[model samples]
Target: MTFTPVTPSDIAPGTTRFVQHEGAAFLVVRDGDGRVHALDGLCSHALLPLAGARVRRGHVICPHHGARFDITTGAAKGPPAHCGVSHYPAQEKDGMIELDLNP
Candidate 1:
């Protein structure tokens, strides 16, 4: 399946927005490079919403347990969160950012 574009630039570079598609809530993380990436958006460790994660040191830091994840690849970088997140492919076209959730 394909991921949808559901946000704008006013939300800030590191800000995350929660989206519901097909009854599933996914988190979209926008990095400093102006690229948008999609992921499960929830922490695998404590099932906390990753959107609440703070952007620091090039990683999304989970607020629940301080779990950090790579925004691009959704890879967990430290303890309290061993399971990595799901990643979606994203691209920009015509001044809009779109994502492919299947990737």
Candidate 2:
């Protein structure tokens, strides 16, 4: 699988960051446990900027409408959110986080 290095693993938790590559945007946030989870930068239910959303309880909440999403499976977790976001495979090696995004 092809992968693009996004960010380093040394980043502190609770800090949300953005990564744009190949026309797709990625929202990378270091969870409370220090593991990084990257999801689509746009909310699946709406065109909201996910960078402003809260990363709580391992779900990316839509900053616009409170729609919740599961980062692990890219699935919508409730109503007002019926669409699922495209999730790329991610891996952390050494001290960097990488994502495999398809066009």
Candidate 3:
């Protein structure tokens, strides 16, 4: 699978960043534990942007509302979001965050 590269420094630990790769929006997250994740940038609940969302206890809380999504599995963890967003394969390589969008 092809991979998209993102600067690791762009996403600090315990933060979420908005990114556009290959014409699609994505949320790059660095959890409190330093694990990286890539998920659809829009909240499934209302198709709202998750760019500045909050990360708590391995979950990304939607900024628009109170919906929560699992950073690892992209599963909808709370109400108003019954459907999960796409979870892309993410890894660190060569000092950058690489995302497999086609995975």
**For every candidate structure, what is the RMSD over all alpha carbons to the true structure, in angstroms?**
2.1, 2.3, 1.3
Clashes of each: 0, 0, 0
Poorly placed runs, candidate 1 (over 4 Å):
93-96
- Model 2: lowest-lDDT 10 consecutive positions: 9-18
User: Which residue pairs in candidate 3 have backbone atoms (N, alpha carbon, C) closer than 3 angstroms, thus clashing?
Assistant: none
lDDT of each: 0.73, 0.77, 0.88
> Which should have the higher TM-score, number 1 or number 2?
1
Write the number of the candidate with greater lDDT, choosing between 1 and 2: 2
Question: What TM-score does prediction 1 earn?
Answer: 0.81
In candidate 1, what are the lDDT values of residues 2-58, reduced to their tens digit? 746655534468777777666666677777876677777678888877657677766
Write down the TM-score of every candidate.
0.81, 0.80, 0.91
Native-vs-model 1 lDDT?
0.73
Query: What digit string (tens of lDDT, one per residue) describes model 3 on residues 1-103?
Result: 8888965645779999888766788899998878889999999999988988999988999988889999999999998899999999999888888899778
Ranking by TM-score: 3, 1, 2
Residue 87, model 2: Cα distance from true site in angstroms: 1.7
Model 2 misplaced stretches (Cα beyond 4 Å): none
Q: Name the regions of candidate 3 deviating beyond 4 angstroms.
A: none
